[model samples]
Target: MRLSQPRVHPLTNDLTPEQAEVLAPLGQGGVIPAGPVLNIFRTLAHAPQALKAFLTWGNYILSKKNDLPAREREIVILRTGFLCRSGYEWTQHVEIGLRCGLTPDEIQMLKAGPDAGWSPADAALVRATDELHADQFISNETWTQLLTHFSQKQAMDVVFTAGQYTQVSMILNTFGVQLDPGQTLDPDLRVG
Candidate 1:
């Protein structure tokens, strides 16, 4: 939504030798198995080394080792994408968020922000994500609220997840990564 069209287009050809090697770890039998590679992967393939590094870190954020529940992680990611106004990121993650346990109504509520009647635990996460997006740091009060329900590690992962998606939203928005086939942007996220 940031750019009307792709500033950098996704790779449409077979991978170069290096692209295949660097991206192979992202494929089956590596750090994270790949299905059909998405446009984001193809676009990022322009910088294979960086994309490899990204996959490693991003895998940690999405993996079980992150300590935050999958649902909680999705909440932070959705909030980050929504706040960053990245329609591509929002649409991609909406399906993932649903699978991770957020309902349609709850996903809509994310756009309304932290005070949209979340449970105390969920609200703490929303507020922290909001602070991180707005201030690049969560306040002490929000940190305290987060600790009331989340372990110190979970709190860290909350920040980690939010931060990752903030960067991802930037990439998706800046690159004009359009929705994949059959995907539609949320009505509320429509930009003129």
Candidate 2:
């Protein structure tokens, strides 16, 4: 939401044959299909090696390797996306969040932040995200609360997930990555 329009347009003629070949594997699977590439992927394709490296880390975070459950991970991701006001991140994750078992109401509550009437466990998750966003470190109180519901690995995953999404939000915002075709921006995420 920081920029009115994309600073870097998606790849059209700029991609070399080698770059195109490198990005070809990304089209095979993941968030997008193998056809008309999404603007995000296309723009990222500009740096084929960096894009490939990013996908490796991204795959881990989105995969089972991160100790947080899918639903819990979505909670962190959605909250992080909201705090950063990254429309692209929020819109894409909204669907993924729902698929991971976050109710529409719970997704809405993420906009309100940690005190949006969530249960203790969920509230704790939001509180950790908020703390990390505001202070760049989770407070001891929030850490304790997180301990009640998550294992040490899961707790660490919370930090990693929040951190990863925070970085992603920055990329989406600063790069002005727009929502893909047929996708609408979340009302709260709209920039002036």
Candidate 3:
């Protein structure tokens, strides 16, 4: 798939200052700064209740503060990004995925789907999400294998997380979300 590379404006403290402050602790290194979304958020003046709900759900999945492990959460997100071909989603998460312990190879394997020599459990999780995203449901065999390793709660989390990232993938792709200026793209993500 051809990835869209949008042009980003120069880094500025001019955008959504609040969101920038929030993202600071995430260690962005001033490379890929937050873009126009912040201005939209700020223009709303206060957190739109709808956007707040979305943020809450996203925060839960991204941090897995809801209880799923970090590695598992990244796996769901990275797979979703690749399946949807969301360059913004894939680029953003690849950095976090590495921090969460997913090697570049494992993240790349996500493009190969679940059968790329990953462990049975990891493979099952990837395949389950890919199938669910594309087909809106998973095969029974994949479901059973998923149940074998992850608890019902985790299974649910994975499903929700995949759906969440899929939504993000659509938005980023549709809106032409650009990688922040000077932000490093994931070296492992092949550009075409």
TM-score of each: 0.93, 0.93, 0.74
Computed on alpha carbons, the lDDT of every model, listed in order, comes to 0.87, 0.87, 0.69
Q: Provide the RMSD of all predictions against the true structure, rounded to 1 decimal.
A: 2.2, 1.6, 5.1
lDDT of 2 at 133: 94
Question: Candidates sorted by lDDT, descending order?
Answer: 1, 2, 3
Kindly indicate the candidate among 2 and 3 with the higher lDDT.
2
Instruction: Give the alpha carbon lDDT tens digit for every residue of 1-192 in model 1.
Output: 777689989877677887877655444533223466677888899998888899888989989999999899999999999999999989888888898899999999999999999999999999999999999999999999999999999999998999899999999988988777778888777777
Which sections of candidate 3 miss by over 4 Å?
A: 1-49, 184-192
**What residue pairs clash in candidate 1, if any at all?**
none
What does the lDDT come to for candidate 3? Answer: 0.69
Which tens-of-lDDT digit does each residue in 1-110 have in candidate 2?
66768998888766788678766776565544456667777888878888878778888899999989999999999999999988999888998888789999999999
lDDT of 3 by residue, 49-123 (tens): 544566667767766454568888888888988878776678777878888899988878888888899998899
Candidate 2, pairs of clashing residues: none
